[model samples]
Target chain A: MGGTAEAAGGAGAPARRRQARGQKRIEEILRAAAEVFGEQGYDATTTNAIAARAGISPGSLYQFFANKDDVARALAERYAARLATLRAELDTVARDGRDLDELVAAVLDPLVAFNLAHPGFKALFARTDMPAGLREAVAPVHAAIHGRVAELVGQLLPGRPADEVARVATVSIQLVRGMIPLITGAAGEREREVMTGELHVVVVSYLRRQTAGAGEPGRA
Target chain B: MGGTAEAAGGAGAPARRRQARGQKRIEEILRAAAEVFGEQGYDATTTNAIAARAGISPGSLYQFFANKDDVARALAERYAARLATLRAELDTVARDGRDLDELVAAVLDPLVAFNLAHPGFKALFARTDMPAGLREAVAPVHAAIHGRVAELVGQLLPGRPADEVARVATVSIQLVRGMIPLITGAAGEREREVMTGELHVVVVSYLRRQTAGAGEPGRA
Candidate 1:
């Protein structure tokens, strides 16, 4: 987020201020859209609902986006931006000498929580019916996340080829991607806890095997 | 699939014959629905297309199914039936006393392939847009699969609570559920191969840990 926000260098002051305001307004609309879309789901949520949630006039909403799909596209772009920042942060964490388990927890906690917190994401990407373009728009962000995770895994298990670590990273991410919903979708607190704990075992156990005879503590 | 298929004994002979024909027609229609749905996807697929694929008139199609959703429901039923067969076969494998890795390879290979082979499933369940009922219809089958997997895990790791094994099984299954798409949706064969191998690393690694010190060969 640091330096991610940049003002136009050559633009006149007024135009620059107006552009900043435009960007802020767009961000608000996307946030509101995410909330509404998450709660009511894509099919039930409407532009008016988003505008209402965003505390903007319908006209103001139109100034930024023409319809719900447009808002969704904008949201995907915002998610990508956030993901880029997350990746940068993750890169720094990997570079630091933090314990790999702690580093993984630091990175994955917020990452998966991002899904649980934003119902709109599950509604959009999880659903089979959202426009393919919306999922496609965000693919790069997912890929970027995967790439960063692979880098971190490679750093931890230094002896392994980058390629092997990458495959392991993809498996880990995909396993979590599949498991998160089942956890979130669990019938009760106990069930959610059980699933989460088991998932931790699944991931950690897999990693220990991959890093066995090589990296870090906690190996048998 | 034996006793599951039966003509009413009390009914007149002609009526019984008609019922059998009706059942056969339904199966054909569902198979055709799967092909069309797999190829074109859920939303893009039409009832007419399904009917044509099944080689029946619109009226004949309607006699069995009210609409596309009905076809999807029936397809889910068929999928469940197939899974039940799979579970039974897996149960035998579990009881037959084989190497755990070999057993796992035998079970998971076809199970994952089932998803890749059936594009209609990806079209239906994979879609963010599919109706809740559609997802719900298949939930029991998934649960059943989880239950069977857990049972097998418990058999391998005797003395552990069935519940814990079941939970681990759920994690493994969910992990596979999540990985298959990434594998099938992989950009190229090479990427897919890498992902598949890593997933093998993941599941086997986790299982080895779960059953560690309790069961199987090569335990050190």
Candidate 2:
């Protein structure tokens, strides 16, 4: 893998060594940034503290980041990219030619998986102190994720307008996203199951209605 | 009217008058706390900063609050009580035998109105860093809201299981709450309208399906 090769290069090689050192430093800074930002929060998190956590001098930190805001923005870009990757996986699921229930699960499962896999990233994104530039930068990826889900819903309901499908898609996504805290145990296990099971039923019922229409012949 | 006079009794009058004065200070502190926490954010805001914003001495602030955490918890309790009041209004609406659409509107309108009326409080509650005590305390209100909506949905479709009705209720509420940011201009007007119309259509269609099922001989 690229990551393994890059790590093996280390800082003693040559020209690539300099690049690797720079990249490694940035990674170290980002790890520290996430910890500090998660614990003390974004606005309270300082560049100096990030530097200290990374065991780097403030000047070295400044060489990579203009300020704390810069580091946060960089972190957001990385997070957006990661989300984009997960969104792509969701797109794959959407195209799996499954039934409506499977389709809905396809769209939601990756999100749940991503949140479980990298909770710190989710925590960082959840913080309200995120910079405007970072938010704006992240918008397109979020929009792309939404657009892909909407497109999948449209596929499942061939008769529905794209816009209409997008609407239902947005609402369905909203339903699951709202359950994040519960799904992740912030709301406790019993509450999580209650919410998740409820969401499952609602998604299925809503999708069935959208596809079957009101009082469609022979419909349950 | 009596509240105003009782609140005014907090003015420095005498030793006996200290009680009202202390109460007024706490109220002032809480108001200041909400505004600061809303505007500057929870973690970024400081107790001294809130005291200054309240136009009170730090000592006076301390007299009413042990720390910013205490003030925030108090403010959260106050906001939770306001939400409860709003829920009471929704309960009345649910009991009034209104049409399905009207019942849905009744539940949502008050919540929207409350957010508009107390943007500061809304912002504070929306923050992810809210104390665990505050989050746990609000869970019952959320459950009650879900339960009331479930009952109304059952009334609207007389034969659905109480659990199914509750699931639909939770989905609907989550749909609205999730889009609050979008509806309030965080996601732009066109997006808001499309989402609102889509959710309206979904709800209507789903309810129609349930009602139709009731008319079928030997069907759910």
Candidate 3:
């Protein structure tokens, strides 16, 4: 057994190097796919385009993904994971006892950054014609975000019913979701900044009205 | 010339009748297309299904539209015209001396009814993958609504700059647009009503904040 283990380790070292290379290629392909999808949208994009952008042969691209839908599904999974991380960070922020304005900024600023960094995420997620597998991959992340927002909402409006809290949270999330396209599609950086500020005002204002007189005395 | 006119009238009679029948068939096909598009979304819907739903043969359906895109474009034109009419009505409502609550209700209620009556409108309008021609057809109505809303914002905030008013109006319109799916996709009619009311609260709250100290002396 000792002799067999020693022999296997020599092969395992090269195998591990190959695995690392494969993983790096996969990441490169995904990053390239994201950019192409973000620029052209889902339907207009093709695997060839992604391969070209990634500087890989079509055969190499095919080795990693079956088709464009497969690539989109992988991208959706990537976005879901990133969103989960963001939500976890937001959970931490929510527990920090920030005021409502602080909370709004904490939540939205990271979200805007995430959206900017991952422009393809919205391109895929926002598609009405998205394949069911891709939608399934994205849906839970959305629900998790909604759940987290509802928890925060419940905290803010302590005496409110669960349903009302959930409703408000849903509306709040939708409001942010709706503004994303506008913010991302802004004509210039100045326009984007102004729209972002407007979003903060819209969200913070609605939340204040909803949570008015409901916050802890000191918090209010 | 007299004999030519009489001869033309005789041939034109059946041509006119055929034209009327063609128009009626087109409307039925459009009505059916709208329902199918709403139920199954654009990608899943096929011309055969639309023809079947409209109680026409595929051959008959082809007489009016070239393909699904053509059908969708026609439907878009129809929606654009209806939305224009709705906008004119909204313009009348804006001119009336209604308070903000009444104004919001006036705007949203009819819009909700329009969405309900034509579920396919939101289906097509909300799609990120919508075809360019269809999008162009819908874009003007959206812009007109935005323009009208911006005008109202300008009135409410009399001294505010055009850009700020435009931004507020864009956000306000987006807030309402964001809620349409939630309101329409609610689990039940009761939930729908609750979501609709919540939407009203959200829009009203945000607008009130934007317009709070800006309304005219008597208006405030």
Give the candidate number with the greatest lDDT: 3
Best-performing candidate as measured by DockQ: 1
Residue runs of model 2 more than 4 Å from their true location after superposition: A1-18, A32-60, A83-97, A126-173, A186-220, B1-29, B46-60, B96-100, B129-176, B186-220
Q: Which ten residues in a row have the lowest lDDT in candidate 2 chain B?
A: B1-10
Here the TM-score of candidate 3's chain B is 0.78
Ranking the candidates on DockQ from highest down gives: 1, 3, 2
Task: Provide the lowest-lDDT 10-residue window in model 1 chain B.
Answer: B1-10
Count clashing residue pairs per candidate.
Answer: 8, 2, 0
Docking level for model 1: acceptable
Instruction: Summarize candidate 2's per-residue lDDT along A65-150 as a digit string, tens digits.
Output: 65555676567667667776666666676677767667666655566666666555545554333345446534654576678677
The C-alpha stretches of model 1 lying farther than 4 A from their native spots are A1-28, A40-61, A84-89, A125-130, A159-165, A188-191, A213-220, B1-24, B55-59, B124-130, B186-194, B213-220
- Which pairs clash inside model 1? A127-B127, A127-B128, A127-B129, A128-B127, A128-B128, A128-B129, A129-B128, A129-B129
> TM-score of model 2 relative to the true fold?
0.66
Evaluate residue B208 in candidate 3 and report its C-alpha lDDT on the 0 to 100 scale.
81
Each model's DockQ score: 0.34, 0.22, 0.30
Clashing pairs in 2: B10-B20, B10-B21
Q: Which regions of candidate 3 deviate over 4 angstroms?
A: A1-18, A57-59, A66-70, A87-89, A127-129, A213-220, B1-18, B57-59, B66-69, B87-89, B213-220
* Model 3, residue A51: C-alpha shift (Å): 3.4
